[model samples]
Target chain A: MKTAKISNPSIVLQLDGLTKKIGGKAIVDGLSFDIAKGEVVGLLGPNGAGKTTTMRMIVGLIGMTSGDVRICGQSVRTNFEQAISHVGGIIENPEFYPYMTGYDNLMQYKRMTAGVTEARIAEVTRLVGMQDALGKRVKAYSLGMRQRLGIAQALLHEPKLLILDEPTNGLDPAGIREMREYLKQIAEAEGIAILVSSHLLSEIELMCSRIVVIQEGKLVTIRSLGESETPTQKLLSISLQVGNAERAQELINLMEDITIARADALTNRITLQLRQDQIPGLVGKLSTAGVEIYRIEEVRETLEEEFMKLTGGNRIA
Target chain B: MRNFTGLLVNEWLKLSKKRSFFVAYAILAVVFGILAYAFYELSPDGLNSTVDFATGTIMLQAAGQLVPVLAVLAAAGSVTQEHRYGTIKFLLIRAQSRNKILASKYIISVVYTLTLVLTAAVLAVVAGYIVYGGGAGESTWSDFLTNIASLAVYSIVFVTMTFMIGILTKSNGASIGVGIFSMMVGSLLVMLLSRYTITKYLLFSNTDLSVYNGEGPPIEGMTMAFSIVILLVYMALFLSVSFAVFKKRDIA
Candidate 1:
């Protein structure tokens, strides 16, 4: 195996035409992506969409039939030790020896990798907010706490890339929020590239800076979240409930910058596409036209909606 | 090399932390104690038997047979429990290669087996000294040394076989079942097949290295060197198959 040198410092993870086949059937075909440092990318796909398979391949937990994954310029196929040294991943669930204390679990990993000192372990434990529970056996830990300890173990070696598959699985609302905040903090604080796969679209939208959606073992799209505004982007969906639904529909249709996507006569609801800035003027025009608007709310395009549209109504979890 | 050592230490830590190992040792200790009391009470000459005989009998029962069973259980569980508990994922994603990981596990199983056998031998010697007043003279030392050496070799065979079973089956129950079956029925099969020329090279027939020290080989023509060679061959075969399958199979 030849050692690979890093020519590009910004890109922390690179997948080049990666493919896996079993029993003459392609599980992940020609899947490719690049994750840059300090960026959190969410991997979204429907059931059996090969998301887990892709993550496993990247981590070298499962062999790929063709192609390769490069972590910090080291090819996983040829230089496994060097490539994997730059990676920390939790495939499906974070599992540890339940009989061992959380600190011992972390120590087990620390021993496997070089330069992971006692101070580093302590620092990572504090980073994951698992300092208090370090001495407790893993069997006594909650799922959220175990997830934190898993992250701490992954971070012990200070890898350039961190891959978490469903990091927020089985967590309560508060636990989910805490995890999201911690992941964001870790990405920024450590400048580590994070690739997280999750079913929670709303959480993904909040947590990830970019979304890579795949379906049927293929890349569907890669969309950037919270990008700077550009010209010629004026479509926004705004839903309205008013007393005079027919008049509101006619008024919205007559407006210059707005077009009604859908209108219900019985429910007195209207969905209009217009510029976000034009909402106030549209509402004014509606009221001036004797349409009593009871509620006017922007129908934000959630990650779920975008994912559903891209996947053609396939359910993602 | 450092990472390999670390992996071995990690595996040892995991095995040591499990309550089952301690429980197994505790039970072994109690059984040794009870056997010592029985030897003391039931002696016709009232604890006048030679220490060699008492220690020899205890060592034969514990090291020769009982410790091998414990070693089998340990070896099987060392690999199978990782899969059963889904902790194999944790090890697979580490910076070390799969070969290193598997090698560490195999080495640890060997270490654990030796430790169990040695501990049982020590406990038996202690019980012999406590029950029977005579010290272990030169003859007893030779006997104990030879017996322990043979038991150690037997442990290697038993552990390697069961470790292969664990890797192939990836289940503790299945591996233990196969191990126990081989231990009980394997010798019987060897006896029934002894008339055939090929039975001289059979694994169970060659496992008892004690035959060299006047225990008598089940087959007449088999020598100690021949049995060692056969055991080594079987060990190589079992280990090669384990590593090949482990390296190729996907961790699901």
Candidate 2:
């Protein structure tokens, strides 16, 4: 796949060596990435992996110890007003005055920025599907509604980049799915860049076009879901059902480039890791060795397993 | 300048929507009504006392003493509520700088306090006329103007003090505690310390500016000009500390 160049004018957010240190330890170390216009990027990391810290630094909620963040070509440190005007974000929970209506909450944000008209407010309310609930006080709304209102407020000014920290947090499965659909619609319809941090991997896999993974404050990998690479192209664990599990395990030990990931004796099933192309050859060898194979299936890796493997078995919070 | 105005408007909108904001005015109305009734019972003849209870000057004097506590409550909540509700993050993320946001909150708080004071003063005057059956006092219009001006200055000092406490503590309870302590116990503390030369410069002592209207200074040898200068100094100090702390600290 072709990587977008640095000179790409569509880049809305660029972080060059962003770093943050607290109490003489680096919480986010030398992090760098760029988000293009109309791109939806997911920030995937375990708890305390510095996703929120990076988001905070981007939004200027906290000072960066080193490096810089540029939004729409304006430096956050030097041109805070101009740079921040081009960006909108919710750092953690999207909090508002509970006594105020959703419209009033949006109005509060509206008054702070320039060129945000009543029409724009109405447009965003409709965009978030919050038009009917705008009159209701925020305290009466559910968490999903609040999140939608928060998105409406963020988009009122038509910012080039939108940053959301755990936008799907505390959401039920249906609510999470709804939020994912809305986010995709916003990104595509408005041509706005979005940077979302979340622990829900399947949601991230479905919602994000690209993913940036970090572990221990360092960049683990950055992958694009849009690429055509199949799951078989990457290392995979395959589960095998056989007539004789013990004999199959011994036969598998004789095979090159294959190792037992897990073994189940009573069920006569074994999980092995190898290249996908070698599965057929392994089966053939096992049958020749008189170990009858009942079933052979590729065990697709869930995002959880891949994340745990990348982070050395650390769970994503 | 537009952003600052917008911030001020936003703060006012939020405050106006709260039940506490209107309840405060309601409390002021009740206090004024009681004061009017008490004055009517004490001077039924309306001619025995040299001081005319019906004049705006008297109203200013009454509110000057009582309304600062209300100002303290309002000003303390201005900053502390945002911190308590974790809503400061929303404001901090805007294009406005921290200082600009804080300045807007501070100025709106002062304006809200002044509005409360003016409303109470007006209520008192109206009640006074209905009870005492007099239109004006023996004092000149200039004396009444000075009284109003001095009351404004005095109330602002308390507002600024409470605002500083709110920013420093970022907790509604702590801000209210300090504000109430300063309003209630402050005078007693100043009275106990009045023997010392520094007592003349204490904030509570300088805050009662009715001395210019012949109400007598809280301390001996304290002039109106001296008290004005002291209050201005303290106001500047409080504002400077508030801005410095707010600007330097990170929003949690």
Stretches off by above 4 angstroms in model 2 are A1-6, A231-296, A315-317, B44-51, B54-63, B135-137
Cand. 1 Cα-lDDT: 0.84
User: In candidate 2, what are the lDDT values of residues B1-252, reduced to their tens digit?
Assistant: 787889999989878998677888888788778767776677544332223542343443454466777778888889889887778888888889888998888889889877976776577557766775554446554655566666677778878988999999888778878887877787788879888877998888888777656768777898988988998898899999999998777664
Task: List the candidates' TM-scores in order.
Answer: 0.93, 0.88
Per-residue alpha-carbon lDDT of model 2 for A165-222, expressed as tens digits?
Answer: 9998888898889889988988999899999999888888888899899977889998
How far residue B143's Cα lies from its native spot in candidate 2, in Å, is 3.6
**What are the runs in model 1 whose C-alpha is more than 4 Å off?**
A1-8, A228-233, A242-257, A265-267, A276-291, A315-317, B44-51, B58-63, B135-140
lDDT of 1 by residue, B72-173 (tens): 888898878888778888888878888888899999989988887777777777877787666434355676678888888877898899999999999898
Give the lowest summed-lDDT range of ten residues in model 1 chain A: A1-10
Clashing residue pairs, candidate 1?
Answer: none
- In terms of lDDT, which candidate is strongest? 1
